[model samples]
Target chain A: MTERGYAMPMRSQDTGRGAAVRSFLSKSPPAAGRSRLPKVLTGIEGFDLITMGGLPAGRPTLVCGGPGCGKTLFAMTCLVNGASQYGEPGVFMTFEENAEEVAANVASLGFDIAGLVAAKKLAVDYVRVERSEIEESGDYDLEGLFVRLDYAIKSIGAKRVVLDTLEALFSGLGNTAILRAELRRLFAWLKVRGVTAIITGERGDGALTRHGLEEYVSDCVILLDVVAHEQVVTRRLRVVKYRGSAHGTNEYPFLIDDQGISVLPITSAGLGHEIDEGIVSSGVPGLDAMLGHNGFYRGSSVLFSGGAGTGKTTFAGIFADAAARRGERCLYFAFEESPQQIVRNLRSTGIDLQPHIDAGLLRFEASRPSTYGYEMHLARMNRDIDAFDPEVVVVDPLSAFRGTPTEIHNTLMRMVDLLKARGVTALFTRLISTQELHSGTDQGISSLIDIWIVLTDLEIAGERTRGVHLVKARGMNHSSQVRQYQLWDGGIRVIAGAFSGHRKPSAAPVLIASGKPAAKPKKSAKKSRR
Target chain B: MNQSLDNDGAKPAGTAAHPRTHYNLRLYVAGQTAKSMAAIANLKALCEQHLVDQYSIEVIDLRENPQLAAGDQILAVPTLVRHLPPPLKRIIGDLSDSEKVLVGLDIRERAPS
Candidate 1:
């Protein structure tokens, strides 16, 4: 069994009306006390956290889902994890696929089923039943199945069992009356054997399982769903019922890659991360001066919202370059541009990131936002961030993610929470329309942001001028006056004076021409030219 | 019909007749329960009537050798498997319904009138 951190005692409020109704619906009392039910850790990432441990130990868990929702894969993962990670051996009794096919299916996920079988740590038994080949006479019982299962279990001394799609027997045999009785017996016998079991079932119209196997396996039930919103599919898992255990009841988005299924318990992370007061430079000296002579708070999330071509990516790149130059690892996520494009574009602004890339101080992960769903993108980013373990993280143009406003906000919040929990400083850029820029509405994620920097393009006297301003900086004093800045070849050069009187069309050309001399006042100013 | 004959003594006498389509049947049972005994009696009676001198019956008790259940893909007790036919077939139950048993064994049309 996997160790759990929050094995909460049974609450008194749970014994109220809701518990009574649930117990009546399940036709059993909620397993007596709040004494923690033993669980078998699945070893899938983020799954044990949500279940507080895993499936109820020495009992069957019904995993039901529609076709291709990864029911079999989930069961196989648990069984394989049990045999490999845990010392307990397992037996996979497949009714839908043969032993070789099951082995081959999970092989891509790095499970060596054949090797495990040969090592006596695992067993695979494929129960072949064809209705066309068998004729039913007067009376019969499924004792032969019991005998085969018993023999297989004893042969391997298995401590885990997976009956992948046991409902296939209903179609293979003409006797449902007997089959149902035998199924009940099988579950009872499984519990008696003291081995944790997983039984996969197809989703029915109204019930959890097509054959109503959920009624038999009352210990635990999980529902896997594949929902599509705007044509983007995301797999979700929910612990529908855990008789004696408290589990996360929310539908958690999960991912199935070569590494197998990993459920992202997004809501498990609260706003409880430890805060840091260390300061990090903004890479541009003038911008640093505007941020109270220091920079963003370490481990804080910074948001840069601006209109089109306002140099959001450039600023993000400069921040990443600065972090890398300080010998800290930085992970830069490019949503709209490729890594080569970013490196080349930043090179023109004198922020060459190729050297940092070569030195392994900065890593660029460029992907089209449409390439995956929002949850998938988050999961991939989470995996990358965990792998890289960067000190500073940058996500350029978060608005490129195509989703509803709420979805975008939720994804951003989770991303911010992820970085903050790791005590990593994060900078995220959002490309907003000109109207939203003026209104200061950043898709409702502003509250989660620590530092808000808005960059706008000022159309004055037929020349496009760039202006930068600080909207809010939590826990520190920041320059509030809107400052005019020019994107020079060296980098961003904040003009010496604030853009107070520079909004006039007549005053625009003087500032544009004096951009070279105006940047000379700052002591740490670079030799910049427009 | 010699209903008292054991499974070994129930082999077809004089195999020289009807050599091309000899019926070979294997009856799978958990033990000598009432259902198993009824299935065995029904199977022997039906064979004596339709497949006289052209059939052999082999009874396997799964209770004695449980591992043998997977070989024949047996799930239900009192199962009758036909092995000699080109396409194998299994009839599960007490075999009290001789009509379905004959049809299942592909011998209904060839039954001697």
Candidate 2:
């Protein structure tokens, strides 16, 4: 029991209601509450805001990650920092590293662990299990460790306890059965005593945590991981299980430096928002007129859900560039491609986002979802929202939000909350197969979306045709047509809708015909052979 | 870019302990229960083996000093700490096995010089 913050107080299960009714009721309204826990900041950036505060203060939080990742550092900095920054006493018990070893490792990252120990603000307990020196009796418990730890914790009145490498006891100790039982007992015991504890465990191969500590610690489990793509290292963290709180559910990239690890979420919290009156074209002239008043709201969430080769991201870049042209700051959270890859492709579409990137009007960030859980992704967005203060956030391919552990329904709900609260215009592109569309709940997030723009690929009689359709727009009178659209050298154009065709296009990138094929490209000498 | 790692390998070694007299014995227990009774028995056996020559066992069962739980860093039943020894060490569970108590609690028969 790691201090339950919210509770049913009665029921054991969900007896809510039918599908449609529940969907409407899902995601608790942003209600203000009276939770005044003197929460210590996680320093992992955006993490604090999403949880309304940080993880329930003064309790156990298990941070599990694979080897060579940032688990040990994350644990150390908290203690080193909580002691110095918040004036909270901390005790670090290491089953793997001694005081000296712990000190030197974190010293590079700028934590003065050695100094803290010497000053008596922090205590380090290195439990060594040397087989050469000690013989084992299977019937024994870890009372020796308890006493030593008790002494250390008391000496400093430690409000925080970090058992770095919680799995070490299982390997080095003589008994696993007894160790697991004691671990369970230890967590329960820590709660009654009231100390914020962080227990770091080695992630099991092919599993979340090696020892299955997730089943043990109930309050929260933050999974941190380093993703390697083409030799680039991006560290991420996610809240796997957060009891009684709304948290971001995306694998947001984090950075480790002298101040320790900080997770920067790209999701914008719509707080402290200032609306802009400027109505900029999406660089797709035909699609703009069909948008009734033309273009999107200053800080609204614009979603583009479609199949491949429908020019979804290409169109997104044009909007991003259009905003940059007006000198408004914009940040793009790309999940599918690196910024360089995006720049390379956008260049072909004749939209140059790079110059704006250099001019401080735009930024491009890339990450893999498998690196962390959903919360981490939200936190990472929050970090960027704070840093960039962009008037617009373009997350190309919103469908990628569905990554890892099978499903991410809760994550989308939290993300929606973050966007509304931040008041920053967000653009999310989703990938929904045509099959999923026929089955309503397959892509459940569509209804939650403020604006649903579906891009369709029409392969009528073997000649490829493209159409852009607006399914719905809440609070706005938008187009409801399967309008024809095409890509020329510069950008996109919507010609006219077959059923409900009303708007016509003018100027650059305008639609002239309902399903006009793309003009043949000026052949390059090398492409001539093909 | 392999760098030298530290933590267990660095610092002042902190293990060059000094010779001492009147070893301080602390027996840790949750409360005065049957398990504690067995711990006191096991501790007594350990004391008779090594510290009998120059020391005593002060049973600090947690039943008395509940506030002192974290001070000693107790996690489970029947722990023994040699606070008197310069380089203090700990051993948990019942102090039933005398040989383990000698090496773990570090009660070596003072090496004959």
* Top candidate, metric TM-score: 1
Report the alpha-carbon TM-score of model 2 versus the true structure: 0.56
Candidate 2 structure quality by residue, lDDT tens digits, B24-96: 7777776666767776877675455335555677777664565565565455567666677656666666655
Instruction: Give stretches of model 1 more than 4 Å off.
Output: A1-35, A501-530, B1-20, B109-113
What lDDT tens digits, residue by residue, belong to model 1 across residues A134-227? 8998888888888888888899899899998999998999889989998999999999999899999999999999999998999999999998
What range of 10 consecutive residues in model 1 chain A has the weakest lDDT sum? A1-10
What is the TM-score of each predicted model, taking all chains together?
Answer: 0.85, 0.56
The residue ranges of model 2 lying beyond 4 angstroms of the native Cα positions read A1-33, A36-39, A44-74, A100-123, A129-159, A163-285, A368-389, A399-414, A431-443, A457-465, A481-483, A495-530, B1-113
lDDT for each residue of candidate 2 in A101-167, tens digit (9 for 90 to 100): 9888988877788778788889988766553433442156665566666667888899888998777
Give lDDT for model 1. 0.80
